[model samples]
Target: MKILIPFYSTYGHVYKMAEAIAEGVEKVEGVNAELRRIEEAIPEETLKEIGAFEAQKDFAHIPECNLDDLKEADGIIIGTPTRFGNIAGQVQNFLDTTGSLWMEGALIGKVGSVFVSTASQHGGQETTIRNLHTTLLHHGMIIVGLPYSFAGQGTIDEISGGSPYGATTIAGSDGSRMPSENELEGARFQGEHVAKIVAKMTV
Candidate 1:
């Protein structure tokens, strides 16, 4: 079974979580995980001016996701940083291109999940995941999320981003914070959980 992890990250925060999710998916024997980057919507000059150009280099080697990638996967995990309580425009742009897929029901019954990064602890993490879910539901996908059994999402000792909606990490206002171990663990658990479900469905 194959699972595609398609994501857009201005900084490397969401990318790190994507890697952790891939790791978890790989732990499920017979499951293959693919990481694909969403095309950048910003101009090169603008990306340089905002420092996103440099930060994006870490994931530049990843392949850009294509519609065929979506069609072939048994499951999909989307990772996007929040943009004012919603998905980033780049992610929106990518999803917007799926009209053909929706018309043909190409993604029907496939497992769909999401992960995210935000500038603050309460920065619309749940809303962003739910907003993404709307698109998945329209495509007739089976939605999966980070279940409460992950346990790390309930910690009160530190400020972290995670919920029943999805896995998330707080990037801090200045974008210096990387995903903590707990947040990454949540991502891994979600990935593995989705892979397990997909495996059974495929069988």
Candidate 2:
């Protein structure tokens, strides 16, 4: 099974989260993850505070997955950095362009999940994950999330990453908190969980 992981990252934190999620998805036998980044029309700084030196280089100018990837995948997982209690402009813009896919029912019945990173503890990570869920629901995709059974649920220090809605990372104030080992494991568990569910449903 092929899983498409499409995301947009500003400060590289979200990108690392995506990578961890992919690692999880690949852990399941017979599944592969396709990692794609949303292309911004105009290049932007990787972090607003970091200035030019930290600007993210533009990827190919495409939004989400190419139609071909969406058509081919058995599942999809999206990631984005939080922006004022919502998804980043780049991710939102990319999702907006999936109208044709929606009309064609290209994404119907596919398993989907969302992940996000925030600069603070209350930076709207849950809200952003829910927003991503709304878009996936509109496309008739099946949304999957982290189960409480995973190791990190409810633990004090280990509770910072992954959520019942999906996966997430708390990047701390400087956007420099590398995802902890627990958080990384949680992300991978989410990916593997979704992929396993998709496999069963498809079979």
Q: Each candidate: RMSD to true structure?
A: 0.6, 2.7
In order of appearance, the predictions have TM-scores of 0.99, 0.89
Q: Return the lDDT, model 1, position 104.
A: 93
Candidate 1 matches the true fold with a TM-score of: 0.99
Q: Against the true structure, whose lDDT is highest?
A: 1
* Candidate 2 local Cα displacement, residue 69, angstroms: 1.8
**So what's the TM-score on candidate 2?**
0.89
Q: What is the alpha-carbon lDDT for the whole of candidate 1?
A: 0.96
Q: Which residues of candidate 2, in runs, are more than 4 Å off? A: 41-49, 52-64
Q: lDDT of each structure?
A: 0.96, 0.81
Q: Native-vs-model 2 lDDT?
A: 0.81
Tens digits of per-residue lDDT, candidate 1, 16-69, equal 999999999999999999999999999999999988999999999999999999
Please count the clashing residue pairs in each candidate, in the order shown.
0, 0
